[model samples]
Target: MRLATGGIMHETHTFSAEPTAIETFDVARGAELWRYAGTNHSVGGVVDACRARRIGLLPTFFATAVSTAAADRATFEAMAGELVAGIAAALPVDGIVLTLHGAMVAEGFPDAEAEVVRRVREVAGPDLPIAVTLDLHANIGQAMVEASTVVVGYDTYPHLDAAERAREAVDLLVATVEGRIRPTMALVKPPLLPVPQAMFTALPPFKTLFERAHALEAAEEALVITIAGGFPYADVPMAGMSVLAVTDADIQRAERIARELADLAWAHRAEMVIRNVPPGEAVAAAIRHPERPVVLVDVGDNIGGGTPGDGTVLLAELLAQGAQDATIFIADAEAVRAAVAAGVGGTVETAVGGKTDDLHGPPVPVRGRVRLLGDGRFVHEGPENAGVPADMGPTAVVRVEGVNLVLTSRKLMPGDLQQLKTVGIDPLRQQILVVKAAVRWRGGYGPITRHAIDVDTPGLGSVDLNRFRFEQLRRPIYPLDAESTW
Candidate 1:
């Protein structure tokens, strides 16, 4: 069976001032993006399942354009044009599978995933089966549902199962292509939940919800059951919790199951709340206990969540306290370039971060000795980002007195331990490790961290989505309006 694969994955924060241009994305074309975009572990398990079943795999093309900026209309159209053109060239295909982030918002288009699917369907001529896998934080819209036959979303928030969801999309596509099943999708958008960190499935109420969803999936009529705790930062009309169910030609069963799951999510909407502690307090808490490695999470400035990864709030606090043996990664291309020009062991003075959006904090000036430098490209050794070759440009490990800082030309999500090792900084030996991310860090840094604290550092990817005025979002979402009942 001939098939085409490609997608644009970005959890765009509508309030972020950073505009995602064509160059903003780490674009991997043709075969080069297979490991980074195609075979992620979250969807890897499904691919293995398909391989075990002896399904013919067609290598049409796979591209990943992940950016941490609010994509403009031009950027969205350009990406869509490239993906559509690529897929059209590989036409006469039996099926297509796309991996989407689900919360993307372009300048004029709120439902960017729908636009992509619409364009692909227009190219494929509607007869070909189209399937997609979405992040758990997908803000799925009616248009997206109308454009595709089958859609599957990640069950885990930290997204440990990205490969598994991709596998499921492939599995459903194979089934549909083989005429074994007619998959119909049913989606219900209730109210919005807080950031993913608060509603993690590894713990309590969420665990119960997942368990129940799993049980529902085991029922004879159900094919796929997914609860998308939507990404609140994207101010789209469909920005809310949704329950999607895929059933074998049974629209009634699909609708019933989806409604049941949506009702469950709505019942627990109040439970999804995030609280952040100041950076100074978090550092003090970490310093008090030297027995375990304390992870300081700079959530607001998380690059993975659509904020510039160049916040100096945490770094400034660490410096003020004269913290020793602490490691922090700052994405400042200027600083890295300056350090590389000065060469290793050379003393350099530069300003880092606070340059992207000064509302978060001002740039901190630092005079440090360049300890190590690299080309800023490395394959991730961690499970969360494994097999993905990341580029941080010309990076340098700078030692400002006793504090070791990682300065990079490219932005990183802080999910790889190899990121530190590549620059001669060991995270395991450090007393405190500051990561610019939300919960995804748990998959990589969980083993090394004695304790992980979610700190409130000011930036675009704020946990409190209400902090920013959202003009495009649908009104009466959760936390923003506690009295509203969806």
Candidate 2:
């Protein structure tokens, strides 16, 4: 059997002022796409599954970029055209597999992933079996459900289950190609927009919800169940929580299960909202505790959720409190240039963060000694991107007082311990670690930290959905309306 694979993946934060240019995207095709073979990513899982099934894989074009604002129109066109053309070239395939981020919004394309499926379906005809996998934060839509043969989403929030979910999709694709199961998917979106802060699968509310979904899967009532918390940053009509149920040729059962899961999520809507502590109070509490390390999460500047990594709100509080044995990362190209010029063990004075926009706090002036300079390249030793090489682009470590400020040219979330260990900072020795992220960081740092706190900081990635003005989002959503019903 032969299966063609590849698609475009991106999470668009429409609220971000930063524009996503064509140069920002990473494109790979043909043999180059084989680099994902051993990584804990979507493509990696597809490669392994094909090998195990002895299926001839036709690798095609795949493009992705870090979460950012709406993608450029020309870039979006080029990517979509390339992916569709690849599918056209690799004809006579038994099935297809696509990896997509369902929340992607580009110029002129509100439902980007659905557009990809539509273009492919137009060329491959309606009878082709297509299987797709999406992130847990996908903004599920009816158009997406109707276009693909079957859809599967990551069940875990930190998204450690990327390969696992992709393998499941491949299994379903093989089953359909063998004429075993015909998938009919149903989608249900509740009138709620719960932030990513309260959507950790390991904790309460979400844990129970995912457990219920798993039970349904074990009972064979549903082949796959997805509970997406939804990305609220994109101000679109479909920007909210969604439940998708896929069953074998049973549309009614799929719809009933989806509705049941959606109502259950709506019932616990109040418990899903998380409160935050101010930066000063968070620092004070960390200092008072006897634990060796405490993780202070900066919700507003979450790099994974599409915010600039130069937020200085928490940095200012740490400096003001004269905090000791603390470390934080900032994406500042200017700081890195200055530190590199000063060389190791030399002192450099420069304004370190908040240069991209006025949404995050203003730049805080800091004078620190350059402790180390690195090439800013390391493989993720954590669950998020295990075995994948990350490039921060010209990195340096500056120690201002007792705090070690890691400045990089690229905006990267703190997802792996190797990001710090590559620059000589031991994660186990730090008294306080300020991570500019929400749930994603917990995959790596959660196991080592004694406690983690989310601070109510100010930036584009605010947990409070009311902080930003929405011009296009549909009304009557949770917290925004409070009395909204499904």
Candidate 3:
């Protein structure tokens, strides 16, 4: 059997003042897509699965990037047109597999992933099966469900299960093509918008829901089940938790299981709330902790959640509170250029961070010595996104008053330790570390740090849903509205 695969992925933060331009996306065409092989990413899983299944794989066009604002109208259209055209050119394939982030929002396309799936459906006639893999943060809608034959979402919130989900998607696609199974799906959305911080799958509440999903799948009651925590940052209409079930030609079973799981999640709605510590208190606590390294999470500037990585609130607090042995990463191209001009071991006097917008915090002036410099390229050595190569453009580290400030020319999510270890800063040697991220940061920092605190810093990615003004979100959602009911 032959299968064609490709899709665009992004987690859009509608509150962000910036528009994701075409220049910001990373594109991979035809043979280039195989570079992801051996990595933990979805693309890598697709390549490996097809090889193991002895299926002919046709690689198309794929473009993705770190979470950010809505895609520019022209940029999204151009990419979407290219993606559909690529799949069209590779016609006569038995099936297709698409990897997408369902929370994506572009200008004129509130349900961007659905739109991409729709376009692909138009290219490929109605009979062919299309299998899709999605992140756990997907805000799934009926359009995505009606367009795709089988939809599979990651079960783990830190998203360690994406590779497994990809393998499952490929397996389902092959089975459908062979006439071994007829996949029927059902989707349910709860009135819940739990923040990512409180949705870690290994813990309670969230864990219970997935455990039930697993039980049903293991018993062969459902072919696949998904419990998405949903991306609350995107102010789209479908911005909430979702439950999906796929069964072997059994739509009734799919609908029954989906509704059952959604009800279970809603029953635990109050526990799904995310509470944050103030920046001042969080910094002080990190310093006082008996642990050698404490992770201070800047909830507002979460890079993985599509906020600017240049948040200065925690950096300023670390300095004002007289905390030492702290390392903070800030995305500022101007600051990096100034440090590069001084060269290694030279002094740099300039303000770092908070350059993109006024929401995060103003830039903090500092005079520090350049401790390290590199081209900012490394493969993730951690459990998450392992074997994936990351590029931060130009990068440099400046040390000021016993605190190391990492400045990068572009916004790179701190989802892996190699991002710092490649630059020569030991992760275990620091007393306090400031990570501009939500839960995904735990994939790297969680295992090493004795304490991880989520700080209520100011920016577009605030943990508090009340901080933003949503124009397109569905009303009467849980936590957002106390009286909201299913």
Candidate 4:
């Protein structure tokens, strides 16, 4: 059997100020996509699954970028055009495999992933077996469901299971093409917009919830079950939690199982709440917590969910609280340039962070000595997306009072430890560390973090859903409306 592979991935935050331009993406063409084979990303899983089955593989085109604002119309069209063209060119394959994020939004396109599937279907025809793997935080729409043969999502929230999900997608596609099994899928969305902070799958409430899902999957009637804690930042009509069940040619059974899971999630809606402490209180708690290096999660500046990585609210609080031995990353290219000019061991006074937009906070004045400088590139040492290459562009480490400011030229998710070690700061040695992320930061810092506090700062990824007015959302989602019913 042979298969063609390609995809575009992004988690769009509609309220974010940043725009995802085509030029900002990391585009991989043809054989270049194979480089991800050993990584923990979904693309890597595609490569691994194909090799294990000895199936002939043809790589097409893949484009992705870190989470950010919705792509402009032109950007989406250009990328989608290339992806479909590449798949069409790699014709005569037995099947096709696609990796996409479910929460992707573009200008004039609220259901972007569905649009992608429809375009692929136009070229692949009605009978071709097409399989897809998506992020767990997908806001799944019905359009993609009817077009693709099978759709799968990661089981883990920190998304350690991304590659695993892709592998499963490939397996299902191969099985379908060989006539070994006919797959039928059903989707259900619960009207809940829970924050990522409360969605960690390892320990819950969520852990208990996923266990029940596992039980359903183990039953002979179901092939797989997916629980997607939808990306809430995207103000699309489908923005909420979703449950999916895939069965062997049994649509009725799939629908029944999916609805069961969805009902369960709705019943537990109150438990899936975001508990955010004020920035001042969060800093004070971090300072007083006995645990060395308590992780202070700046939910408003969440890089993984697409906020500017330079929110200064926590930094301002740290300064005000007189916290000691703390470390936080900020993205400010001009500040980095200034630090670079100051050279290692040179003192420079400059304003840093909150430069992307006024929503995060204003830049704070700080005089600090530049301790280190680097190109700001590192390999991900992760349970999530492990072995992927991450670049923060030009970087400089500046020590401001008792705080170590690791400034970068680009916005990056704090999902890996090497992102910090590359700048000569050992995270384990710090008393407090600030991560501008929601749930994914746990893949790297959870092991050493003695305690974690979610801070409520005002930016695009804020857990408080009411902060941004939603015009596109399906009316009356929970918390936003207390009377909202499942």
lDDT of 4: 0.90
* Model 2 alpha-carbon drift over 4 Å, by segment: none
Q: Which residue pairs of candidate 3 clash?
A: none
Task: List CA RMSD, all candidates.
Answer: 2.1, 0.9, 1.0, 1.0
Name the 10 consecutive residues with the lowest summed lDDT in model 4: 203-212
Model 4 / residue 222 / CA error / Å: 1.1
Checking candidate 2 for backbone clashes, the offending pairs are none
Can you write out model 2's per-residue Cα lDDT over 279-330, one digit (the tens) per residue?
A: 8899998877798788999999999899999999988988988888899999
- Pairing residues by index, what is the TM-score of model 4? 0.98
* lDDT per model vs. reference: 0.79, 0.89, 0.89, 0.90
Model 3 agreement with the true structure over 1-486: per-residue lDDT tens digits? 899999889988888876798887899999999998888889988999999988999999899988888998898999899889989999999999999989999999988999999999999989999999999889999899989999999988677876778999999999999999999999999889988887888897989998999999999999999888999988999888999999999999999999999999999998898788999999989999998889999988989888889989988888898888899999999999999999999999999888888999999998999988888989998578888889988999998897899999888888788888988889899998888888888887778888888899988878778878878899889788878877
**TM-score versus the correct structure, for each prediction:** 0.94, 0.99, 0.99, 0.98
Model 1 over residues 67-185: C-alpha lDDT tens digits?
45567788888888888888888787888888778888887788888899999999998778999888888888889988998998888756778887777788888889999999988
- 294 in model 2: Cα distance from truth in Å? 0.5
lDDT of 1 at 318: 91
Error of 4 at 321 (Å): 1.9
lDDT of 4 at 319: 92
Which 10 successive residues of model 1 have the least lDDT summed? 58-67
